[model samples]
Target chain A: MDLFEYQGKQYFARFGIPISKGGVADTVDQAVAQAEESGYPVVVKAQVKVGGRGKAGGVKLANDADEVRTHAGNILGLDIKGHVVKRLWVEHASDIEREYYASFTLDRSAKKHLGMLSAEGGVEIEEVAVTNPDAIALIHIDPVDGLSLDTARSWVDRAGLDEPARAQTAELLVKLYTCYTEGDCDLAEINPLILTPDGRVHALDAKVTLDDNAAYRHPEWDEFAGSDVEDERETRAKERGLNYIGLDGSVGIIANGAGLAMSTLDVVNQCGGSAANFLDIGGGANADVMAAALEVINSDPAVRSILVNIFGGITRVDEVANGVLEALERVHISSPIVLRLDGTNAIAGREILADHLSDRLVAEPTMLDAARRAVALAGGQS
Target chain B: MSIFVDENTKVVVQGISPTSQGLYHGLRNRAYGTHVVAGTNPKRGGEEIEGIPIFATVAEAVEATGANASFISVPPKFAADAIIEAAAAGVPFVVCITEGIPAQDEALAYNRLVREFAGTRLLGPNCPGIISPGRCNIGITSGDIALPGGPVGIVSRSGTLTYQALHELSQQGVGQTTCVGIGGDPVPGTSFIDCLGAFEADPDTRAIMMIGEIGGSAEEEAAEFIATSVAKPVVSYVAGVTAPPGRKMGHAGAIISGSKGTAQAKMDALAAAGVTVALNPTEAGEAMVDIVRKLG
Candidate 1:
């Protein structure tokens, strides 16, 4: 899960890493108050989980209270990459002598922790990788060996960091590694790890992505739960424990696995119709889960037809069919459902669905047929 | 001639009991003629689950049953330790069917297996495990859908999609050599490259059907491997063509981050490697059918 910049900074601070003093605010008055408390020349950054906030004019410098109010009012509702700013992070602006980048993520192929450091910063690392790949010093650290001070110092030297700030940068890199490994973070990025005119180095921007699977180990992450700026449908789906992504198309999709769910959406498009949403019921296709999924999709006015494709292995097709039937009784679905059941006990599952065929309920012989029927019912003629 | 398992491979169940999913799938595996000889449960060491002897440790189970492979079905929290225990017991092959294991734990387990237990092969901490049809059934995948024989080797990142591919192949009267789910986790114990390499080396497996979803560089790397090493006809299908970026599509690893790990990117890479890339799973089945028929 992506955290807001403020939350990322706070997470950084927890690892004893130095960040610019900052405060988060929810209102214009609170922004001004935070700015005043942090001293003048504060950077009012829009607290959003997305990138390109600066290009979108979501980050503004305010020297006084009036300017702080003006910028807060402007940025609070400013949309960056479809993310509307609801909160503001006002931090004391730093005096930068130079900018650099540092991040630690999993080297999935190598099965190691990958540390990327570059003297060139304040821009996308991908850009630096394209222009001058040598500018970025990449290091692979085994989770067993971990990141050491000597290793980090050598890395800092390789990245050609400012000699004066190399010690502090290396120290900060060690702390960041701790936060990345021990803090249950998928990614801990400090873009533009800034060097001050005085020889101090610290993180200027924090882009942290926490591992959702590690949530079981870290209970403190509950504080970051309410920080997400999600749409209504996404929030509802999260509440219902369904893996769903809302889209603008007409055919609502529900499938058993991630790959099949995505394939269901692709097949809907292949059948000349777009999908209203992407929902994966996972391994559980019980009555309650199916009803919850149907109810969530039914709430969307854009969904004209629903397609549920389950190729049962651990999940039996008979159970899925019974679940669908039982779900129909629990929820009054306005959109017609096209189910394509295959795999274990599918003959019995098809037999169960045979008695319930109608305009509202239909069964298809295959996933492609189901998509074709759902797309046509959704008014996407094919 | 199967890659991972066959009639001679003895299986030991870790965290197995009457109520555990290990025993559940273990029983089913045994019913399918798999040598599910022993189970490990510290509490039920002297007990038995449907005639399968229970042992206190994987070492005892391995010693008693001569099991060369271990099937892990422990919960997420204990999964990493269970893997270590199985590997410590000197099991040559360890397949972890438990899902939702923390990436850190998975990483540490992989590291230990690499550093300390170098001889042991680990498949997944989150996967459907493997099946050599009419021979050995390891994990949660239903054995009925699998056709027992040769000509096709299948590997997938998704369990249901693997079942779909198997169903599609069986429906067309094409038998498979072995099917492996490499798992969709960011740090899978085994990879597409590993399975692809095994499949390429197997004599009975004539053609390969690879089912990949948008996520890591594993599939792209496998494409490169296929281009350089694999000599068989390869048909590929990657899911999430219409999926939006940055959203987890059910599988923990099935997310498109930024412009990377997209279905289009993976498909393009595989296509550039001279592998047949299908638009969807059904079409992929057709491509594989045509390829196999040409081989005949």
Candidate 2:
């Protein structure tokens, strides 16, 4: 649900937010062309979902077309935070008289929409929060009342903005809130919203996180389908229509519920085993989803062993057991499996699994026993 | 006595038609003292679902059956509306079993429901729902996890984990007052802190078992509450210790974003506040029981 920088800029533009005009370039030649089109003094930014790109040399200021080509070539295949710089956004550089930070996101504590404004905006918001929490003005707006001009003005003033800048800042806050709600963004941040020497404010950068569940309502995202930016394991899982995310651990988990899957991951680490990934096949503990989940976990080389935990209530335990057996038969896997099955038809389910799994399946009476066995089979740290 | 549901609770199903996945099993839920007053599906109105009357609207169902709660098994897209309808109809509790309700929709639904009906309690959108031992089990979670009458009050973000944790507790001869899956959406209809507050006040709950994950400030908030209000022995664990940054682990809400919401941070916070930290799910029961015994 996180949009790359280029996509964020595009979305911002659609919302009438002013972003320095930029063009996405795939190759060195395209970057050079884009820089030339923008007429020198351009910023070449890597279009990745990660931060710290500037420090990683994924961002470069190009004075001329040649510099743009060089920087773009170097950054194109560069990896920063596990995301390759496959594309760059070549934008006309702006002259900043001052930089300010502004973002709108959900504040769970306040249990309302929150807008943050900082006088020192060009740096990481984390630094701002830690170093000078007071420098950042945090305002919570009731969803029903919405953000008003007066409230926005007070927030701007609280951020220590000058009177003239306060008016613009207030206006900008209202616009940003509109963009957040209407655009369905979980996070809409414009770091370093610049005030040009001419006294005009513009969004220099746009970071957006659109709700993924809203994708069905936006058919326009169809063109964004098959985006090559995702990790290979994620891409493969996506193709198989299974919910999968890769992690950096040795124990792979396959659970039926989201909450349980996360708990499984936590337990694995608590037991001195790191989880390689989080996989939830939902309520369908049947053979198809389980098989798909196993295949996805098997694709990760970091996974040394697999854990299958099911608390079948509406879902039949026997069905999940059959699915596990089906997955083992369909996919060639070398890792060991530790399974805990309970609930309706659990005895029958365990019987079915016992018949098929024999020695390969490590079944335990309780969750703790199962986790211990799985960790031990995978060569526990202690 | 159980917390949320019991033999006298009248339950209504949002999707009661044969087309739904758990309609037949919902009938079995009736045997546990769930009245199953009515099933809602406009298309199947006036028909009988497992002999339970079907109604077109939640209002009609609630009025006719005096249903205090609802169990929704509708598809994801329509689930939020069904929840809103249930709230409008004045159902005291609504348990939505549908998964993948859009986060925005959930946010909207939760905000509206909590704002409009302060008395109403909602369990899940992509969850297995809530169960109150012998009182009534409206969710799809297994029955064995419930031990007729237990003193432990459980609040979890995951349905399966809730059952697993309780099953472990039940095996140790620990009973539960009630077990609730608050759901795993980024914006849950009910939160762990909210349920923890209720569990803290319930005399039947001698100990509290909380399962959380790496997202938002829910765990941190719970920690603050536990530090201030909760007098009972609290045994807790936070999942997603190894979840990668940026990627949401399984659950939409189960991601370790910055430094604050990590499992390590949550565990540290809980431990600092005198809550026993279960190193893993396997150890949750023993840790909780030991804490309870020590408190006693």
Candidate 3:
């Protein structure tokens, strides 16, 4: 779950990381008020989850209330890489002496926590990694031992930070590590962590991606839920504990696992049909879950046909068939549902569904055949 | 010899109880002829799950039953600690079927194993475990869909897709030596490369089929390994070509962030490595069949 920049800044502040004084404005009037509160010379930055806000004219510097209102109005509705700006982050502009980069993320290859600190900042880290690899100081910390203040100081030294800013930057790195670990962030990046003429250091930008798996531990994460770009179908599916993604197509997909659900979408497209949504019932494909999945997909106006693809692993197919039958009694689906059940009592499951086979409820032996049938039923690709 | 598990592999199930999902699969594995020797639960120390003895700790379970491999099916909160306990108890290989374990816990478990228990290999904290078809079934993969004594070896990131690849191959009258689900998480105890290297070393396995999805460089790294290290015929299928950017797409690791970890990139990497990259699972299975026919 990616957080808006303003939210990230606020999150960093929660961990005692110094951030520029800022206020989030949802309206143009609020933007002017925020600029006045910040004492002018504020940066009216568009709050979107994409990069190049400056290039897209979404970022502007305002010296006064009039300038704040003008820039805020222009950036509030501006689109950066297809993300329409609905919020503005008005922050007091910093006096930058130099820019440096710092971040903490998982090193999937090493299966460890990786921290990168670079003297070079204010640009994509990937570019620096490719062009001047030595410019970035790479450190792999064990999640068990995490980052230490002493280790962070040497890392800052390795990154060739100025002597005056070294201690503050090192201190900030420790705090950021805490934010990454205790905060349950998948990534905590501060590009262009600025060094002021007064020898103070602070995060000029924050890009945070929280780990959704850790939401169970932190109920406070519910506050970040408002920024999520979820649709009605997704919210309904979430209510039923089904993993569903809304897509703009005619065929609705229901599968047993993540890999299979994604492959189901690809197969539907291969059969010349687009999917309306991607729904994974996971291990429990019981009556209530099946009924809830059907109700969510059935609500989609684009859905013309549904494909139920279940391959029993921990999930038993015969029981899943019974669940589907029970689900049919609860939810009245408008479109046809093509069922393809295999693995673990699949024959018995097929035997159970044999009596219910009809124009509305059909079963195919193979996923390819089931997908083809679903696509044909949905009137093919548009 | 099969990779990971074979007839000689004695198994100890952690967190197994009469009503737990661990016991449920434990019975199924025993029914399939696996040596589900002992179970460990602190609370149910003397209790048994369908005649399988339960011990208080993995050390006791391992000592009593001589179990070399451990299968974990604990809840999310305790799943990592279970893996750590199994590894600490000298279980050389641990496969965790429990899902929703926090990334921090998984990372801690993974790092701890690599550092302290260098000999132990953890397969997953949230995954469908491995099956060496007709020989040993580890976790939740349905043994009925698997066929034994064949040339093809399979490994996948997705559970159902792993089964789908097996079903697609078995339906075409082909069989697999072993099929492994590495689990679709940000940090898996095992990787595609681990299973690929094992398959490459196994003489009975002639060809390999790999199923990958979006997120992480596991697929790309597997491609590099296949290009340089592996000599067997490799066919691959990468899911999530249609998955939109920045969405979770069900799996925790199955998301496209920014411009990285796309299906196309992984597929391109695999193809460049002489892997038969199929656009879909069915097509991938068919490609493997073609490879098998040519080998014949």
Candidate 4:
């Protein structure tokens, strides 16, 4: 659901928002050609789906095609936040007159479409909101209606945008909202809705996150899924349709439901343990989903201990136990497992688990006890 | 009396007919005690699924069956409009089970129904809906998780976690009054604070089990509300305690953007408000039961 910066810019360009002319290059030769196409004074940015790329040295500016080739070769295989740079976005450098931030997203509390505009751009909006809340103008739009030009203008003006830039910023803001709604974006932001020296407003940087649920409507999403960029564990998990997200920790957690998975991670942390990943088997912890989840977790080298926390209802606890047993037999698990099974058919689930009791599998009767056992085992303190 | 829904509630099904979701609803409703008044599908209007009459619109269905509440099983794109139609037709409560409604549409529906109409209450656009044990199982949540006679009040941000929490409570012989999944969407129709206030006012609810997640200030608001408004013993568990900042996990509300909505912050706020914070979901059940027994 997250778009790389280049793709975001491409999407913005469709709405008449000016972006530094850029094209994605796959190989070193292609990148050299792209740099030449864009001419000198181009920025070659590593196409990784994470932030702080600049700080990570993934973004480089080149004076000529020779420097472009050097930087492109260095960045192509470079890793940023565990994601390898396979492609680079080659863009013409920009001269900024002023920098500002504008974003549109749904605000849950107000239950309305909210737009955030700030004169302070090129920095995290959260910082602006915290350090100087007044520096940003927050506008709530009636979802049934839409963001209006008048409201958008007022918002830009309130954020202290100069009159000449205010009209252009307001015009760009409405276009961004239109793009957001039409593109099915959960978030469409221009961190620096830049103004050039020529009095022209352009999106210097585009960051768009399309709503995953809305993918059904946007059939073109399959092309932009970026399966190759995802981690091996996540890729495999996605193939099996299991909800798995990798984290940096030692304990691997498999819990029913997203909340419980997250809660399991919380419990592990509270007990002095950190979870390596979050795997939610959703409502039904059937054999296939459970097996897929376990396979995904077991694939992670960082995982030292596994925690299977199930509060069974529609998903039978006994079934989940059987699935765990099945997954263990199929996969070569290097870590110890702490099991917590409760709710409907919990007694049966425990009975099934008890039947196959081993040193590797420790069945805890309660969540607290399970968490403690899992944390200790992961930390090698058990 | 239970919170949100109880045994006395009459239920109507929206978008129920020959569809796959309708068939599932038919089988589930037959097992649960929800008074099946009418099912609505234009193509199959006047038809009966397991003896529940199908009507064309929410207005006709409510008028014909005298239904005050509706269970919406429509597709995601149309789900919001369905809730709006039900609300406009004077249905006080509409539980939308349609998953994956866009955050924008969900926001639009919630603003119009709950904020605009005083009589209307919306549960979810992507949730399992509400379930009242021994009375009526109106939503998609499993009935086996409920006890016929219990007093614990449950509210959660995730549907599966609600069931998970209920399973834990049922295992401990800690009966519950009603369990509500307010939906994990950024623009859920209901909120934990709203559910908590209802549970606090309910005489039958001996204790409260609140399940929260990182993201937004909902948990903090709940803690603030609990600090002064609620008298019942509240045992809480917040997800994403160890979640990395700004990462979007599976649940919509489990994103930890910064220092604002970490699980630790929510836990701290709840603890400061005198609510018992369960380190894990499993302990949440046992903790609530123990608190109620001690308070009693």
2 against 3, candidate with superior DockQ: 3
Best first by lDDT, ranked: 3, 1, 4, 2
When sorted by TM-score, best at the front, the candidate numbers are 1, 3, 2, 4
Classified by CAPRI criteria, candidate 2 counts as medium
Global lDDT scores for all candidate models: 0.91, 0.80, 0.91, 0.82
> What is residue A256's positional error in candidate 4, in angstroms?
1.4
Off by over 4 Å in 3: A27-37, A66-84, A130-134
Error of 3 at A93 (Å): 2.5
Residue pairs clashing in model 2 are A259-B158, A287-A323, B6-B135, B150-B175, B150-B176
Better of 1 and 2 by DockQ: 1
Off by over 4 Å in 1: none
Chain B: TM-scores of all predictions: 0.99, 0.95, 0.99, 0.95
DockQ of each: 0.83, 0.60, 0.76, 0.63
lDDT for residue A106 in candidate 2, whole number 0-100: 77
Q: Which tens-of-lDDT digit does each residue in B1-296 have in candidate 4?
A: 78777766777888875555755764686578777778788787778877788888889988998888888877888888888889998998888877778776777777777567779888876677787778777777878777756688899887667887787778777788888888777877788888999998888887889988888878998999999999888999887777778766777666876577888899999999999998777677778878767766
> Model 3, residue B87: what's the lDDT?
92
Worst 10 residues of 1 chain A by lDDT: A226-235
State the DockQ, from 0 to 1, for candidate 4.
Answer: 0.63
- Candidate 1, residues A1-382: lDDT per residue as tens digits? 8988899999999999999988999999999999988998999999888778999999999999999999999999888888889999999998899999999999888889999999999999999999999999999999999999999999999999989989999999999999999998889999989998887898999999999888988999999995683778878888999888899999998899877888999999998999999998988998999999999999999999999999998898999999999999989999999999998889998898899999899888899999999999999986
Residue runs of model 2 more than 4 Å from their true location after superposition:
A225-230, A270-272, A379-382, B21-25, B290-296
Best by the TM-score measure: 1
Task: Give lDDT tens digits, candidate 1, residues B108-223.
Answer: 88999999999899998678999999999899889999999878999999888899899888889899999999888988888898999999999999999999998778889999
Q: What are the chain A TM-scores of the candidates, in order?
A: 0.97, 0.93, 0.93, 0.88
